[model samples]
Target: MLSQPNYREIKSSYLITKEAIELAKLQDIDTKKYKELLKSALEQVLDALGISFDEIRGIKKMDAFF
Candidate 1:
């Protein structure tokens, strides 16, 4: 089970990722390239979190984490 602080940390990390992507877009990053980069990075994070894409939909509380 994740502690409250750990949950918050993950949320914050995701927020930063979102912001970075937005900033890249604002600076004219290509959507196709960005998505490719994001997919790779997200895969790594999901693996580190022990959260598989298949399990995401099964865990209601974790649905928004991805």
Candidate 2:
């Protein structure tokens, strides 16, 4: 995700959080806490943006404009 120049910091940060989960390399040792932290971070970001995960991905895909 960070490889995309079109992805701003917020989007990159979001992807980083996801990558952590995908790679099982979260800083927190506890799996439950890892999920909680990722969930809380995602929820706070989405709540502030007034959108959800699916919506963001849809927007990104549409942005390809091909």
Q: Which candidate ranks first by lDDT, i.e. highest?
A: 2
Off by over 4 Å in 1: 1-29, 53-66
**In angstroms, how far off is 65's CA in candidate 1?**
20
**Per-residue alpha-carbon lDDT of candidate 1 for residues 19-59, written as tens digits (9 for 90 to 100):** 45435555565779977787777778899998874465464
| Steric overlap count per candidate | 0, 0
Task: Quote each prediction's TM-score.
Answer: 0.34, 0.32
**Top TM-score hit:** 1
Clash pairs, candidate 2, are none
Our tally of clashes for model 1 stands at 0
lDDT of each: 0.64, 0.65
Candidate 2: residue 59 lDDT (0-100):
47
